[model samples]
Structure formats: C-alpha cells, structure tokens
Target chain A: QQQVKQSPQSLIVQKGGIPIINCAYENTAFDYFPWYQQFPGKGPALLIAIRPDVSEKKEGRFTISFNKSAKQFSLHIMDSQPGDSATYFCAARRYRDDKIIFGKGTRLHILP
Target chain B: DAGITQSPRYKITETGRQVTLMCHQTWSHSYMFWYRQDLGHGLRLIYYSAAADITDKGEVPDGYVVSRSKTENFPLTLESATRSQTSVYFCASSGYFGDKDRWYGYTFGSGTRLTVV
Candidate 1:
C-alpha cells in the first residue's frame, strides 16, 4: 500500500500565478513532512519541511500548509515562475525511523 | 568537493546480465540509501544502511542486492537484470536520525540512469 498519496499527477499555471499540490497520508505516527523539488536530469532536492505540531511553514515563495488532524499537507508556490517547472514529491516519516515514504509526485509546469 | 555521487550516470545492459550501481559519500554520514524512480510510481526505496555492515531492505528489494562494507560506499547489484528493473537510481546520505539537533535532510546524488535491453 502507498503510505503517502499525492494528487494531480500534472499541473500547469501561468507565471506569477499560484499553484498548489496536495498530499495525504494514513499513518498518524508520522511526525515529519517534507517536500522535494526535482528538475529533469537532477535528483530531488529539499524544498521545505514541516512538523505536525505546526500548521504551516514557509520559505521564500514556497509554503507548506499542514493539517495534522486531517493527515493532509499541501505545497503552495507563490508567484510561480517558468523556472519552477519540475516534479514535486511529498514525503513522510516518523521521528524515530530513518526511512521516508514518498508520494507519487506531481509534475508542475509554469507557462511564461 | 564533498558530496554523494553515483557512478556510470548512464548504463545499458542485456537481460540476464549482471549489473551494479555504485554510490559514494564523502561526508561520512551514518546512513545511506538506494532508491529507484519510475514513471508514475515515484521513487521507491531498494535498500539502505544505517552503518557499516548493517544493511536492510526497503519497499522494493526483490531482484536486487546491496552491501555496505565501508562507511562511504554502498553498491546495488542486480544478479540478473530484467527489463522491468530499468529506471533511474539515486543514492542519498544523511546523518543519524537519532540526532535531532543535526538531522539535516537527505543529500541525494545526481542519479544513474540504467537501461536493460
């Protein structure tokens, strides 16, 4: 079973617009949630992360809105740019465990 | 000059042949992992090592083997290649998860694209 599930396998937004990608998880034991961004021919890099204790976290133009009770989290990109086009993945893990379960990923595109 | 790296950025092999993907890290991180990414399936873990000589299976381990003889190197071996195994493989390293203060997120390598014909 997929521990983490992501929606909208692909997304498109105009530059300067906002694009949102969402993910849901079943494991309540999960304590850490992180989003990764991957460009073609490159490995996924950490974008931003949030702990369940907080409702949201932001870094630059990226924001992670997390709902602990709902077991859901979403990534929102503000002022989306053409360079933001890439694949995004959401992951979850427990505080004591070393393994991270990743979502299926969403490919995002920004039209100039 | 110090980071994780994958070998043979690209490789092509015939079915039934043996192939191995190599990964190395210079930061001496205590944890190393192998993951394979496929279209629509995302990235699935193949194997991981918490320390030297301590290796464990991940979400997808069938038809794959891994070893951690040294702190810096972890290699994944396919005893017999299969068409289904063709995908982009990535290696990542991180500090001990037990260390809450220094638990920097995983650092990934450039990845190796392997094709099984």
Candidate 2:
C-alpha cells in the first residue's frame, strides 16, 4: 500500500506568490519527514525537513508545516520565483527504519 | 567530485539484452540505494546496500541484481531488459538512516536514462 499521499499533480503560480503543496501519511510511527527538489537534468536535492517533535520549521523562504495529530505536512514557498520551478517530492521514514517511502511528485511552475 | 556519481548517463538497448548501471560515491557513506523513476510512478526503490558485500532488495528488485564489491561502488544489472524497465535510474548515498542524527536526506547522483526497446 502507498504509505504517503500528495496532492496537486501540477501547480502554477505567479511570481511572488506563495505556493503550497500538501502531503499526508498513513503510518503514525513515521517521525521524520523531508522534501526534495529536482531540476530538469539533475538529481534531486534536499530542500528542507522536519520532525514531529515540532509543529513547523522554516529556512529562508521555504517552510514545512507539520501536524502530528493529523499526520499531514505541507510545504510553503514564500515569494515564489521562476527559479523555483521544479518537481517536489515528499518522503517519510520511521525513526529507525532505513527505508523511506516517497509520495508521487508534484510539478511546480512559477509564471513570470 | 566528493559526491555520488552515476555513469552511462544515457543508454538504449533491446529486450532480453543485459545492461549494467554503475554508481560510485566518494563520501564513503554506509548506505547506498538504487531507485527507478517513471512517468506515473515517482521513485521506486530497487535495491540498497548498507556496506561492502552487504545488500538487500527493495520494493522493485525483480529482474535486477546488485553487487557491492567495495565501499564506494554499487552496481545494478538488468539480467534481461524489458520495455517496462525503460525509465530513469537514480543512485543515492547517506551516512546512516536511523534515529541517531535522524538526518536521512540523501545525496542523489545524476540519473541514468535507460530505454529498453
């Protein structure tokens, strides 16, 4: 079964707008959540991550809002730019599980 | 140069042919993983190696084999290529994936686009 579910197969927003992507997980044991971004011809890079101990974490213009009770997390990109266009993937793993499950990716586009 | 790298950036082969994909990491991480990316399927793990000579099968390991001869090299082989195997392959490395440190964000290599006819 797919453990993680993500929405918005494709997203488009204007420059300087806030773009958000949501993800929910079925396994309550998952304690670590991370988001990755991939460009056209390159490998995916770690963007930001968070743990259930906290409700939210922010770095630069990227923020991950998590809800432990709801078993959901969403990524917010503030002042989205054209350079932010890429595919974003959400993943999760139990504290001690070496295997991490990934959600279906969401393609984001920023219109100038 | 001090990160994971995948070679034969692109390859094309016919069905029933054998093809191998190479992955190398300089970080000397304890964990290395292979994943395949397709149009509808996002990224599916094919195999993962915790250390040299120690490997395990992932969700989609059928029709494939992996060998970790050395700490820095993990290779995946397709015994017989199939049209269903035509997808982009990615290799990743991480230090440790458990509760300690709890940082499992991976360092991925440039993908290898394999096409099986």
Candidate 3:
C-alpha cells in the first residue's frame, strides 16, 4: 500500500503562474512532511518541509500548506519560472520511524 | 567530495547476471538507505540500516541484498538481475535524530542508473 498518495502525475503551467501539487496520507502518526525536487538524471534534493503543528511554511518561492486533520498537504510555487520545471515529490515520516514514505511524484513543467 | 557518493553512475548488465551498487558517505552518518525510482511508481525504499551491522527491509526488498559492515559504506547487490529491476537507484544518509522536534532531511547521492538487458 502506498503510504503517501499524490495527485496529477504531471502538471504544466505558464511562467509567472502558480503550480500546486498535492499529497495525502492516511497515517496519523506522521508528523513531518517534506517536498523534494529532482532534475533529469539527478537525485532528489530537499526543497522545503513543514511540521504538522504549523498550518504552513514558506521558503522563497516555495511554500508548503499542511492540514493535519485532513491528512493532506500541498506544495505551491509562487511566480513559477521555467527553472522550476522538475519532478516534485512529497514525503512524510513518523516520529518513531526514521524512514520516509514518498508519494508517486508530480512532474511539473513551466512554459515560458 | 565530502558528501555521499555512488559508484558507476551508469551500468548495463545482462539478465541473470549479478550486479552490485556501491554507496559511500564521508559524514559517517548513522543511518543509510537504498531506494529505487521508477516511472509512475516513484521512489520505493529497498533497504536501510540504522547503524553498522544493523539493517532492515523496506517497502521493496525482494531479489535485493544490502550490507552495512561499516559506518560510511553500504552496498546493495542483486543476485540475479532482472528487467524489472532496471531503474535509478539512490543512496541517502542522515544523522541520528534523537530529537523528534528537529527535522533533518536526508542527503541523497547523485544516483546510479542500472539497466538490465
């Protein structure tokens, strides 16, 4: 079973538009959520992360909106640019478990 | 050069042949993990080790073997390579997080592209 589920296997957006990628999880024990960005032929890198306590967290143009009750979270890219085109993955981890559960991932393409 | 490194950025092996992927970290992290990324399937954990000589199976571990005899090295071996096993494999390391309040994300290597023909 997939612990974390992501929607929209792929996404396309115009430059300066906002691209939102969403993920949902069933495990209530999950306390940490993070998003990773990967370019072609490269490993995924940490983009941003959020804790369940806060409703949202932002870093530069990337933001994470988390809803603890709904067990859903989403990643939003503000002023999306062509450079933001990459595969985005949402991941979650429990307090006790060190391993992270990754979503299926969403491939975002920003058109200039 | 100071972060985690994976050997053989690309490899091609015949079916039924044995292949091994090497991962080494200079930070001497206490935790190490192996993951395979496939199209539409995303990233699936193959195996992980919390410390030297302590290993555990992840979501997918069949036909795959891993060993952590040292703190900085973790190797994954496929006894008999299969077409279904062809994918990009990633190695990640993280420090021991005794504090649940603090979140330290994983450091991933460039990844190895393994192709079984």
Candidate 4:
C-alpha cells in the first residue's frame, strides 16, 4: 500500500513561474512532513519541513503549505529556475514508525 | 564538512557474486541506517543499528546483511547478488534519540550505484 501518494509523475514549468507538487498521507498519526530535492547522481537533500502545528512555513522562495485537517501538504517553489529542475520527493513520518515513508516521486523540469 | 560517505561510489558485479558496500560517518552518531532506492520503491530501509552492537531489520531486509561493529561504520553485504538487488544504495545516520520520539534529522551519503549483471 502506498501510504503517501504523490500526483503527476512529472511536470514541466517555465522559469520564474511557480511549480507546485502535492502529496497526501493516509496515516493521521504522521506529524512530520518534509520535502527533498534530488539531483541526478546525488542524494536527496532536505529542502523544507514543517510540523502539523503550523499551517504554513516559508523560507526564502520556498514555501510549504500544510493542511492538518486534510492530511495533505504541498511545496511551492517561487521564481523557479532552470537549476531547480530535479526530482522532488515528499516524505511522511509517524510516531509508530521512525523511518520516513516517501512518495513515489515527481520529476519537475524548469524550462528556460 | 566530511559527513557520511559511501565507498566505491559505483560498483558492478555479476549474479551469485558477493559484494559489500561500506558506509562511514565522521560524526560518531549512534544511529545508522541502510536503505535501497529503486525507481518505484522510494527509499526502503534495509537495516538499522542503534549502537555498536544493537541492530534491527527494517521494512525490506531480505537478501541483505548489515553490521555495526563500530559506531561510525555500517556495512551492508549481499550474500549472493541477484538482478533484483541492483539499485542505488544510500546510507544515513541520525543522532541517538529516545524510542518513537522526535530525533534529529538524517544526513545521507552521496550513494553507491550497484549493478548486478
């Protein structure tokens, strides 16, 4: 079973435009939400993360809008750049399981 | 900072061959983990160790082996490599924390691309 499901296997967005990736989780116990950006031949790095207590958290041009009631969260990259083109992964963690469960993945491309 | 790192960066082996991937962390963190990343299987935990001798299997632990003899090194070995075992292996570590409670985030290694031909 895919505990965390992400939509749109891939996406194409123009540079300077906002690109949004959505993720949902079935387990309500999951309180931690984190998004990671992965470049080819590299490991995934934590981009932004938020606890369920806050509805939204923003850092520079990256923002994570979370909905506790909906058990959903989304990452929005403002002023997307060509360098931002990479595979994005959404992860969720619950108290029961210490390991992070990741969504399939979403490959986003920023067009020049 | 020289954090966690995996050796060989890349390796190619044939079926029935035994291969071991080495993971080293300079931070001396007590918690270390091994994960295999596949196309559809995002990141499945293979095994984890809390301390030098405490080890446990993870979500996907079949056809794999792990050990944490020292606090900084966690090695994973495949008894007999199989085609299905070919994947990018990543090693991650977190500062020791209480069970089921909040723990420090993980620091991941670059990764090792392994191929079983």
Question: Best by DockQ, which number?
Answer: 3
Q: Could you give candidate 2's per-residue lDDT for residues B47-93 as a string of tens digits? A: 99878999999889999999999999999999999999999999998
> Model 3's DockQ?
0.85
Candidate number that wins on DockQ, 3 or 4? 3
List runs of model 4 lying over 4 Å from the truth. B96-104
The residue-by-residue lDDT of candidate 4 on A3-105, one tens digit each, is 9998777999999999999999998878788888889999888888889999999998899999988888999999999999999989886654356778888
Tens digit of per-residue lDDT, candidate 3, span A11-59: 9999999999999999988878989999998999989999899999999
Clashing pairs in 2: none
Give residue B14's lDDT in candidate 2 (0 to 100): 98
Give each prediction's DockQ, rounded to 2 decimals.
0.82, 0.81, 0.85, 0.58
Task: Please provide the root mean square deviation of candidate 3 (C-alpha atoms, Å).
Answer: 1.2
What is the C-alpha lDDT profile of model 1 across B1-117, one tens digit per residue?
A: 799999989999999999999999999998899999999899999998989999999999999999999999999999999999999999998774566755667889999999999
Off by over 4 Å in 2: B96-99, B102-104
Second chain alone, TM-score for each candidate: 0.95, 0.93, 0.94, 0.91
Mind giving the per-residue lDDT tens digits that candidate 4 earns over B2-114? 79989879999999999999999998888788988898677888998878988999888999998888999999999999999999999988764554345556778999999
Give the TM-score comparing model 4 with the true structure, all chains together: 0.92
How much is B114 displaced in model 2, in angstroms? 0.4
* Model 1 lDDT at residue A7: 85
| Superposed model 1: Cα runs more than 4 Å off | B96-98
- The residue-by-residue lDDT of candidate 2 on A1-112, one tens digit each, is 7899988888999999999999999998787899999999888888999988989999999999999889999999999999999999999976664577898899999999
TM match of model 2 to true structure: 0.96
